[model samples]
Target: MHALDYFNARLEATISPMDYVKAKQMSPEKYFLIDVRNGPTHVRSVTIKDANVIPEQELQSRLNEIPQDKEIIVYCWDVWCNTAAKVAKFLLEHGYKVKELTGGIAAWKEMNFPVTNSDQGNNIPDNCGC
Candidate 1:
């Protein structure tokens, strides 16, 4: 099967980029958007708001840190990145709810979804709704 087919199959046979976006809007706090990109690389791209910054290399030891009850949506910098896929598979193997963000952050940006920088001039206020 093609990689895309494999990804869709892993998504319980019905996953799409738009589905993830819709799920994000349903309950922002319900799902965990786990970013597996390295620190330096992630900083240079469009990062999602409140995404968990856990590098792929450290995920094996850090899996316990994530709440198993919540669904995990793994993502990386771009379509070429496989960190998200690997993380998703690991989470699945561990019996945790998991899904890989198709095309990762690049696709998120392409869809014109919200992106923020933690280091940027406080565009978002501490108490203000984002």
Candidate 2:
């Protein structure tokens, strides 16, 4: 494939943080967001509002909990983290339409996007340390 086509194909399967927000706003039920970070890190950090917390290690067993009807959007701690990619690939192999969240929660937080557990007592660390 040509370089542009290769990159375009790759980009077609991912969603940026802002675009996710817009899509969610436009059609809340069209997408199912999953946070694939480990249990410990996820507990310590605030997650995107309404995103299902499914640790990557437990995903295969919890596959039934994910809705096949909706597009699956997966994210991990940050863009550098590959857990979301692994989960996305797994979901795709099982016939679910999947898109990875570019930059994950790190980018969401960086953009100041809203998250669950945002109470004053909630301590979202600067780094996930995953």
Candidate 3:
């Protein structure tokens, strides 16, 4: 089965940042990144490469915009946030293959992964903590 069918709604399996990094390095063509934070928060925070800003609330209507055949990684602000989880649940319900980006953007930067501001894709933020 495809990655989408395995996650999002069904909760059968999920992926982590380490796995994501591995994918980024090995299979960029097979993965898709999603930033589920609200637009304003996304604008104010760091973002990952290839991640699209699709707030959790808007996911229902925008499901088609996400590819069903690729591994999707979703993330929000941090541990206290559930936006990413919610988006994952919604995707699971809608039959989209999706996984929550572990640690959200917080974990991404913690691992020293690269990120960029929404306004301009330059100066990728230091995995600097929030």
Worst 10 residues of 3 by lDDT: 121-130
Model 3: per-residue Cα lDDT over 1-130, one tens digit each: 7878656544434566788888788877887788777644435456776678666656677787899988778888887777787887777787777777767888888888788777532333333222
Each model's lDDT comes to: 0.69, 0.82, 0.71
Query: What is the C-alpha lDDT profile of model 2 across 29-73, one tens digit per residue?
Result: 899999877645435358788888777776788899999899999
For candidate 2, what is the TM-score? 0.85
Residue 100, model 2: lDDT of 94
Error of 2 at 74 (Å): 0.3
lDDT of 1 by residue, 26-114 (tens): 97777877767754542534577777766676678777779977888888777677767777777888998887787777887888877
Q: Work out the TM-score per prediction.
A: 0.73, 0.85, 0.73
Candidate 1 residues lying further than 4 Å off, grouped into runs, are 1-15, 39-45, 119-130
The window of 10 residues in a row where model 1 has the poorest summed lDDT is 121-130
User: Which scores greater on TM-score, model 2 or model 3?
Assistant: 2
After superposing candidate 2 on the true structure, give the runs of residues whose Cα lies further than 4 Å from its correct spot. 39-43, 118-130
For the record, the alpha-carbon RMSD of candidate 1 to the native fold, in angstroms, is 7.9
Could you tell me which residue pairs clash in candidate 2? Answer: none
> How does model 2 fare in lDDT?
0.82
